[model samples]
Target: MPQDFVKIAQRGELMPGKMKRVDLDGRRILLANVDGSYYATDDTCTHEESSLSKGFLKGDTVKCPLHGSRFNLRTGQVLDDPAEENLRTYPVRLDGDDILICLT
Candidate 1:
């Protein structure tokens, strides 16, 4: 694993179609599992700064619970209204049973 990438969870810790929030280095990161594939993104919504993990996750789109803002977990693109800016995405790497997230 790279020095910038740190293990956030185990492979079995998160099930498919579920999401979790990881607080590391004072930053909140949203980790999602979709069909065994993992993706990481900023937990804060671009519109209202609400935690995205508290919202809804359907497919790869995560909807903000506060203002209905939706963002793509894969590419960090905004997909719905009420959000003009896109969320920041992180690279997720799987090493054995470890789920690692890139900080840079």
Candidate 2:
């Protein structure tokens, strides 16, 4: 079986191109609003364990605050090195005014 939706925040709360950190169960999730869509990824930076939600966001890429490692917000892929590990992506859905993250 797979884990289902985890409520992160209200849709009206996060502005586009910004991110917020949410704790779901025991996992730390970085919830980002890119353009008009929402995305969820592991909050920890793949390299130095820095909080990605505090990192810089440019277009669809997020740069690690500690070492400049970049990651694709949509796919959670490692776009730049020093951060060799890919981020774990969570499925996101907009439920009315709430943001639902599928942990499955």
The local distance difference test score of model 1 is 0.92
Tens digit per residue, CA lDDT, model 2, 1-104: 76578678998889998888998888999999989899899999989879998899998899999999999999999999899999999888877898998887
Clash totals, every prediction:
0, 0
The TM-score, computed over Cα atoms with residue i paired to residue i, of candidate 2 is 0.94
**What lDDT score goes with residue 89 in model 2?**
94
- Alpha-carbon shift of residue 103 in model 1 (angstroms): 0.6
- Give the C-alpha miss distance for residue 74 in model 2, angstroms: 0.7
After superposition, the stretches of candidate 2 with alpha carbons farther than 4 Å from their true spots are 1-3
